[model samples]
Target: MNETTTIFGIRAVIEAIQNQKTIDKIYIQKGLSGHLFMELQQHLSGGEYNMSYVPVEKLNRLVKGNHQGVVAKISPVAFADLEEVVTASLEKDTKPLFLLLDQIDDVRNFGAIIRTAECCGVDGIVIQKKGGAPVTADTVKTSAGAIFKIPLIKVDHIKDAIYYMQASGIKVFAATEKTEDLLYSKDLNQPLALVMGNEGKGISPSVLKIVDEKAKLPILGTISSLNVSVACGAFLYEVVRQRL
Candidate 1:
């Protein structure tokens, strides 16, 4: 990890949170408790931030300086607002195409998805603030700079994003092997948001329940499933083909 990528010390971390810095996660020394820790906890109670308690040795390994029992990994890119993105797309008389990722924790997979989405002219990518992968140097490198080119919105929950999209007149689709609906059968030329799930678990049940449609790519090979990034690329390009 880059030194600039993390915020060390309790006061620094607390200040970063208060300043609305995009924090990926925070690491605190185990058994740590004090007035400062309590203050930090109070500030963190407002947003969806991942916090982990680890040994002091782990903190030491992350930084050479005094961490004050706390370290915060910062997001490489700032998040975009979903409403703004949608409104802008509508104002321009363009049918919006958004990608919602649920619990996509692999940095490289997330990066590759972003690259594909950008190429497909996706208006924005929606991700849960806690479960999704952090935008790090590795993600940037894997994206081939597409991370910087695309708009990303981090929501408190994936279901909330689905609800918001539906309210904004965007049809939401869940891509999963659990569904028998074929991807090509759906009309993708309308305002739409496609939900891609985690590598292992697929889309969450709550998210799948609320989506307007559920579709899957047909599997002809003996393999049980496709990699999340490859599946995402196939889905996105299908949308591109339909639009053209």
Candidate 2:
């Protein structure tokens, strides 16, 4: 963890949260309680932040200063509003291409996907706020700074985002190995969002049910599935190819 990525001390953390700073998660010492902690808890009741209780020793290792039993990991990139992004993209009179990530927890994989999305002229990338990987320094490094170039929107849920996109007339395709629909068989030259799922479990059934289509890349080898980032690249480039 980078020291610059964290805000230590109770008052500082409270101020960061109150100021609406993008925070990935906050760590508080177990059994901590006080007027200040109570204030923090009250702010957190809004349910926008993620909190974890850890031992004081763990907090100590995270920071050298007096953390006052609280430490917050700040998100490296500011998240964009999905509705605003979609609206703006449509208003520009260009076909919007989006990548919706479901529970992509690996920072490296997330970075790789962002890199590919930016290179392939994707309009933006959407991810669930809670389950997706936090944009950290490692992510920026792995993305080779593409994280800053690409627009990233964090939503409350992937399924809700899918429905919102569909309502906006954006076709959503879920990339999965279980589907018989081949990726190349689809019409990618349109306003669309591609949904890529978890590295292990794949797209949740609920999300898959709502997607306009489920497309899979061909796997001629013994391996049944490609890595999430690799599959994402294939699908994105296919969209680029179709657009051309």
Model 1's C-alpha root-mean-square deviation from the true structure amounts to 2.0
How many residue pairs clash per model?
Answer: 0, 0
List the candidates' TM-scores in order.
0.94, 0.92
Among residues 3 or more apart in sequence or in different chains, the pairs in candidate 1 whose N, CA or C atoms overlap within 3 Å are none
lDDT of 1 by residue, 115-181 (tens): 9998999999999877677887878888888888889998889898889889989999999988888
TM-score of 1: 0.94
| Candidate 1 C-alpha error for residue 31, in Å | 1.7
lDDT of 2 by residue, 183-214 (tens): 99999999999999999999999988889998
lDDT of each: 0.89, 0.88
**Top TM-score hit:** 1
